[model samples]
Target chain A: MLKTSLSKLTIFILTGFLMVFFIGMSIVFGYTNTSIQLAYEAFTQFNESNEHLIIRTVRLPRALIAAACGASLAITGVLMQTLTKNPLASPGILGINAGAGFAVVLSITIFHISSLQAFAWISFLGAGLAAICVYVISSAGTGGLTPMKITLAGSAISAMFSSLTQGILVTNEAGFEQVLFWLAGSVQGRKLELLAAVSPYLFIGWTAALMIAPRMNVLAMGDDVAVGLGLKLGRIKIFTGIIVILLAGSSVAAAGPIGFIGIIIPHIAKKIIGLDHRWLIPYSALLGASLLLAADIAARYIIMPREVPVGVMTALIGTPFFIYIARKGLSQS
Target chain B: MSKYYSFRILADKISFLIDKKAMIKIGFLALLTLLIFIISAGLGGMPINPLHVLQVFFGGGEDMERLVVMQFRLPRIMVSIFAGMALAVAGGILQGMVRNPLASPDIIGITAGAGAAVVAFLFLFSDHNHSLTVSIKWMPAAAFIGAAIVGFSVYFLSWRNGVTPVRLVLVGIGIAALMQACTTLLMVTGPIYRAAEANIWITGSVSGSSWEKVQILAPWTIILLIIAFLSTRTINVQELGDEVAIGLGSSVERQRFFLLLISTCLVGGAVAFAGGIGFVGLMAPHMARRLVGSSFDALLPTSAFIGAVLVMLADLIGRTAFGPLEVPAGVFTAAIGAPYFIYLLVKTK
Candidate 1:
């Protein structure tokens, strides 16, 4: 058992290192006419030239947004899985993304609210409302807040919100381009002020998640056992719900509804580090950040001057990983 | 022995009594389905009285009125019925095969696949400046191919020793995300007209659905519905668990594969005809199961009926609810079905 654990740890470390290496490589490669020498110089030392503007103003902010969004989503997934005791539970699954998307849609179209700060607040409110709605709906039946119930409720609500978003876009054809861009999710061309607005919430959410990691592990043994050990199930539920809202909401604010990273990364982390949240949370966060950053970099270079959405790149890379983890999980279970 | 013939009659009578409860449930579902259909037809922008609608249906209306009824309302109503039936039947088979309440065409990435393919086609062909008429001909084929790719990928990814429901669901979720990302990417980079067209499709409206769509969709729908009906026996045994199914001499793998194929076809066809219409698949099966128990024979038909009625009602509401400003049936279904679904989820626990 000790030997197996050591091997797993080694694998985890290796994967982490590999991800970082790939991200570095991605940042160096782009569709621009600039030579590799210029790319390196622009990235390493700031200059007032066009190369510096492209690197700092465009690529760097994009990379940061990717990392932040991926990390936030992955952490939210970890919290959700632990809280609901369901592997399928993720921010996207629970309608948090849809809620945020809906709020953004409403703000952009109906109200014409354009400020990033306002967008962030609206997204947060939407996430919170969606979570509460799911909780209330799932809890209404005899099973209380069973994992399956929550999953179903979330799926239903997400589907509904998604359709509503689509409805608004369809009716108001003028906003189609803007809404589509946001919906696809990207970190490109965003101002530093937008990142600053969302950073505090992301930090707070990350802190809260880490603080509750131990409790989550205890809760994993089943609710009755945790309660027997004197843990407050109600308080824990509320706390985790708040963490989900914070992480998912802020991520949406930063980068609109990037998908699959949350669902896939946590599962990958779990396979490497066992079921302990202490290791799982950090590993997943780092892994998610690295994956998103790498994917965003690929998006920039893959099509050259015209970039693909970061969300698409992540999905293309992450789906295969998700399948592997899922197969393994199923076999083990 | 001749005197003992009465005992056989008595035994038959006892068995019939046991079956009566199930028969009654089936009858109630059928009645409710009819009620929903009538109520749905009575609603819409024209606000035709239920009596007038019936009269028009029975060929009692004037020429202009008849034209309006046939051209405007009839196609929408028919599309709703077809789409709803397709979704519900697909969902029922999936839920039974997967033994998970949440397993539906949308959940398994088929709709996403269709959505992605249509969006791509819309963008790729738009630069040609082709007539709107020409584009519609090619869109369904693109959507169908996309759905097939996604369906196969999910199946392949989930396959190991056997296809466990959980693994299938996870892989479906993964592929669905990829498909959604692809749709989003296409929308962002594509031309303005293409993007708008894709958005409308994603919202899942039956608007502008000419007789051509109906013609293309009808045959596939009927064929798949028949196939789903034929597989009911196998599905029933499969749901009992794989070990038991194998012990009972059922080809568990083959049965599941065929069922999944049929479901994907139905879903792909429906999505190609309409867009990513929501809720009918998820809602119909749950409601059907409640009324008809877990028997596949009863559950399949009941689900199809309920699905048809739900979509029809949603479409009617979509057409009439805001007067001239029509809502897509897909939107109303989600807005209405989602909260109720949530309530059901909560209450079931």
Candidate 2:
């Protein structure tokens, strides 16, 4: 771990540079190849060419969305793991993604709402509701929410939401076709307006995550220690919960509930930067952005002309790491 | 001795001891399963009389009644009942083997593996005409292969000194997510019509049940169930924990593997026939434990009955409740099972 401030700063700066490079890679590489020169011209020169239009309209928003979603999801993972005190906690694992996906499908099916603005809010509502349900269920039992209880509760709730989504889709075949890709999760072919819709919420999530980093460091010492340190445990928890919903919800809204980035990035960030949230949070953001951009880039090439969802790519990468951690045992910090 | 009844045959070479109360409870549950079977068979689009359904079962009903009861509804109902029983038994075996209340085939990735296999089967076998190039008979084998591959991998991967329950579950979860990703990738890349078909299968439904599927799944499930029941003594000892089982001269690791194999086979059969019917494996065994206590001999059968009832009821509700649109049985199971699971989580000490 990078202990000295100078080394940490240097690594952080390097990661940020890496993020920029990945974003550029994401933009330049796809089924339709656009050179860096063309990408540059698309940004700088006023050309109404097809490649320019594709670069400007299609690839730019997708890269931006992937980066934003990845960073937001990773931060959400860090907050959730800390909040639940569970190494396995993440929006995807906790039924938040299924919830958001269900809500999106429900809105499309029942209300027939196809507008971009409606999609983002519905996703937030669903994610918040799921997070609340998992919390309430896990906390209600005798032991007051151990990591195991929360994990089980989250998975159970995910099963419920996903089955409900299936029920709706089974009944409405048209809706099945409509949201199938979305449910698998992708940053492909997404409109900039969708990102525009959720960007403010994502921005707030990032800022608040950074602001709350110091308090989280104390909270990591255990609830009793934080309480003895004069922290308002209830208020901080509620604040943390809201930030998680904001970050996770908007990311899901932007990228359709991409999985594993949140779980993978925070752990990787901690390994490189150590456990101090002050450095850890920003470092995770950069690393997460780079990871998703890289995954998105890979998603394009894995099947060639037809793209596999980046969600699948992340799972392919994340499962091995997940298994390693699991085999390493959960007791380690 | 008064609480148990002992039976002997062949000069005590073969003997059985059964708890009288557990027997009574099992009998009552068996009756309840029958009642549910009749009700589910009687309440579809073209409703049949319960008496006529019973009569049709014994070959004494009008041709229309026989067609509706035997041809249309019987296979579907049988599929659900047996699928439920297999899943419940599998869940019971897993919970006992792991000594964790939350352990079940679905939670561990057996079902997900089966789901991925089924989708892959469809994706690979379909020719340009979109019809399966291979016989549909082979699909169940594919699902079984998938579940077995995952189940054994989870077991082998968790093996360091021996397979600890924690590592098994953790590895299972990891593999389950991977299987889910693979399933989704296959579904998304396939044609929309095929995607819908695969979706229904993944969610788990008996909507496409036929006699041939019943023939395959029924025998497979029953054999596994019997094997599971006979191994109850080992599980009961195994549940006492590794040290005690070892102390009792039980080969703990080997028996654990045997039991895991049984549950894996049971799950393989269940998912092969019913698709990925979600929460029955978790819910049924739990409810059975509540009904019959934790003794494996009584617990396994009770779980089977309860599971049969739950899925039969879920299937009934899925097809009948929505009117015109047939929903998959897996959805109703989750709708009920998830809340009950929350209640279990809350109510457990």
Candidate 3:
């Protein structure tokens, strides 16, 4: 009874508590001195003042977008890892984020799509191409897609895309100012309506993720075991791959390619709830949302007056964690 | 008995080279590299006649031609060759020591660590440099100290009982990512002008390289390459695992220490001058192995030559590809080399 009582529900409740607390903190903490009272009043009052406007427009949307992108990327990571059966997999590491970013840049430069939705539509194409490139290139030759090959291929593709992106930026510093925050993976000062543009795809991706979570459990049990249990490996892989692109692309569109959340959150969630995807998925979502909110809040105070990009903050936190895991897992293998 | 002795002597000569075929391949690559070098030096956005390029090189051309070839192009070309040699030798030592193809300085966090340190110095000390020469000279030292610190820390971190290749590579990757973020954060968060300066360095350009920088880099390259060459036998022995190396009377730990030191210094010096130019370290050694085969003695020079050739070509492309608007040499190296690396991954087991 005691063991059962310490269930995933309790974990969910704890995560929820953390999320609400951080969201509240995110809303209240920023350059403009906004009290919790102003946060409540922003929802209640019909005031047209600058302070209330700042609270309603700036902090609120920034916090929400950060959380939304965090959740989207974390879920994407979980799905990618499940599909590939490689613990080291994630959108950032696998070139999906870079791909999405490249597409957004190319569209802005060449097509001059100057609105919110272009990020979503164009990046989706770029993200898909990048993923296919990594997958096809790694799967070639005799060894047939080992973890080592995938990692090497992903990094190489990522390097190429990132180099190209920098080339474009350097050639025309005109685009630099507009995309600086986006390139650095900040949610600050982004147009809030862009959130509305990307939300639908994220929602679809999330729903797809949940639907396949149970199937993912059997798939994790190696290919032969999954086949013995009557799972359609091909269909499952294709579905998971699509969800990964959607979620990863949307996050890149909405925010820049905020990394490590996707890679780290799934690991954190799994530790709390084990490998049961039904439990893991929600835990990952909650933790990711809360963590990014916390990171955003910290980003505000780190170098006061001017804030670092939340991406940098997350990288600082996530890098040590990654190193720890890499040290442990790779050494044992 | 005499016949048997002569046969053994003949076999010893064959084994000295490992393969005649590989030696011929090395010679072919060397010739190809010389041809490319001459072509690159002669032609650019401002074209010089190839015969006149030789004249300009030997101090006999017209004033404008001399200015373009000697004062500008020659130094840039020399830095590319030196930087490439340094990086390739460093990488060759690392890969040979680790027995893993993925163990380049770039992959293993050494370049990023050194780069981050250089950024930190610029952000902290640019105001106090007092002169341009002082500011320029301090960069390599700062970068060297940074690489040493990072290299030592990474070495110690991976040294739990003994270092394993996988653990080292993994930890290196994680640390490399972290250092890059630190670098970017420093660049992004600083004032715009400093940020631009840091950004150019981070991308690995040798633009505006002068005779002074070539002087600084050349000696380091020559000395380090020589040291690296002498350690080939030890590195080859170290590749056969610790127990086997011990059985062969090699002090595995001491040799490994020296090899790591040599690689770190070579890489540190190169990055200090070139601003973390990458893929040469990783790409050149792999190409050498396939082209010249892997007898460490022959392999060292072959890899160094390949690295020099690759970077010279890359720098040539970077300067000329878009005319006055230059792409950084590092960008060209990565853009071209990354695909080939993937192809290598496909080809290799």
Best by lDDT: 2
Model 3 residue A105 CA deviation in Å: 2.8
lDDT of 2 at A20: 98
Name the top DockQ candidate.
2
lDDT of 1 by residue, A1-333 (tens): 112667767766876786666555554557655555776788678688977687667666666777778888999988888787777678887888989889889889989998977988999998998988877876774656665556666766776788778877877777766777767778877777788889998899999989999999999999999999999999998999898898899888888877778878888787667788887887788888888887787788777778898878877876776667667754564
Candidate 1 has a TM-score of 0.85
Per-residue C-alpha lDDT of model 1 across residues B176-242, encoded as one tens digit per residue: 7778888887777766777777777777777767667888788889888987876777788888888
TM-score of each: 0.85, 0.95, 0.91
Q: Residue B188: error of model 3 in Å?
A: 1.7
Candidate ranking under lDDT, highest first, comes to: 2, 3, 1
True-vs-predicted CA distance for residue B106, candidate 2, Å: 1.2
What is the Cα-based lDDT of residue A220 in candidate 2? 91
RMSD of each: 5.0, 2.3, 3.7
Clashing pairs in 1: A141-B346, A141-B347, A142-B349, A143-B349
TM-score, chain B, each candidate: 0.89, 0.95, 0.90
Residues B1-349, candidate 3: write the lDDT tens digits. 2211111235442223235566677688778777777777887878988889888778798999888888888888888888888899888898888776656888778988988998888887756342233456788888888888888777777777777655666667667777877877887776666666666676688786889999989998899898787667788888887788989998777787789889999998888888778788888998888876676777888888898898898889888988788878887787788778767865764
Ranking by DockQ: 2, 1, 3
lDDT of 3 by residue, A84-113 (tens): 766667888788888899889877876678
Angstrom error of the Cα, residue B69, model 2: value is 1.8
Candidate 2 is graded, for docking, as medium
